[model samples]
Target: MMLASSCRRFYADGSLAPWGVLLAILDIWALVNIFGKPWDLSKKLIWAAIVFFFPFGGLILYYLFGRNSS
Candidate 1:
């Protein structure tokens, strides 16, 4: 509910849809990579929760800290 409403506001008559789409794609990519990492299940779950709950910021955090982190 809140997510949809916030996305609608972001669209701004569809002009911002591409940015949303890119973020969604990045989130998916992040999830897939997190799952594939050799880290423990608990660590993966923690990172997954972060990326799931906060998309853009999470992506940044993942790339900055999660990536290359075993």
Candidate 2:
């Protein structure tokens, strides 16, 4: 009974909260855009690493600076 209650609460809390979902969407967008950029393989890899590790901050930085804008 206790285990079932805990599981119910876990789902009730929404496993991926609103911000988590937003961040996931942003990360996916960033990754796709990163690959579409004109940067070389190494730079694209570096940006991918940053986005993978940093998520929110990396997406902001990439859109603000790293993105080629072309």
Candidate 3:
């Protein structure tokens, strides 16, 4: 009964959390810059800013301030 209940609970939530996905993406981005290839200066600066001020405001700030249209 316990095993069945646990199985049902696990399957009840079939969606991945956005925050976890975002963190994973961020980890990959950091890993790429650290272990794979160096990023351009401007892009690196933007990434630093995003990591420094995390959660949501940093994203808004990056989109508004750091992103270059060209």
TM-score for each predicted model, relative to the true structure: 0.80, 0.73, 0.33
**For model 1, how does the per-residue alpha-carbon lDDT over 11-67 read when each residue is reduced to its tens digit?**
556565766767777888999999999999999999998888888778899999998
Clashing pairs in 3: none
TM-score of 1: 0.80
Give the best candidate by TM-score: 1
Clashes of each: 0, 0, 0
| RMSD list, candidates in order | 3.1, 8.3, 10.6
Ranking of all predicted structures according to TM-score, beginning with the best and ending with the worst:
1, 2, 3
User: Each candidate: what lDDT?
Assistant: 0.79, 0.71, 0.46
Model 2 agreement with the true structure over 1-70: per-residue lDDT tens digits: 2112212323455564555666677788889989988888999999998887777678889989888654
Best by lDDT: 1
lDDT of 2: 0.71
Error of 2 at 30 (Å): 0.4
lDDT for 7 in candidate 3 is 21
lDDT score, residue 24, model 2? 73
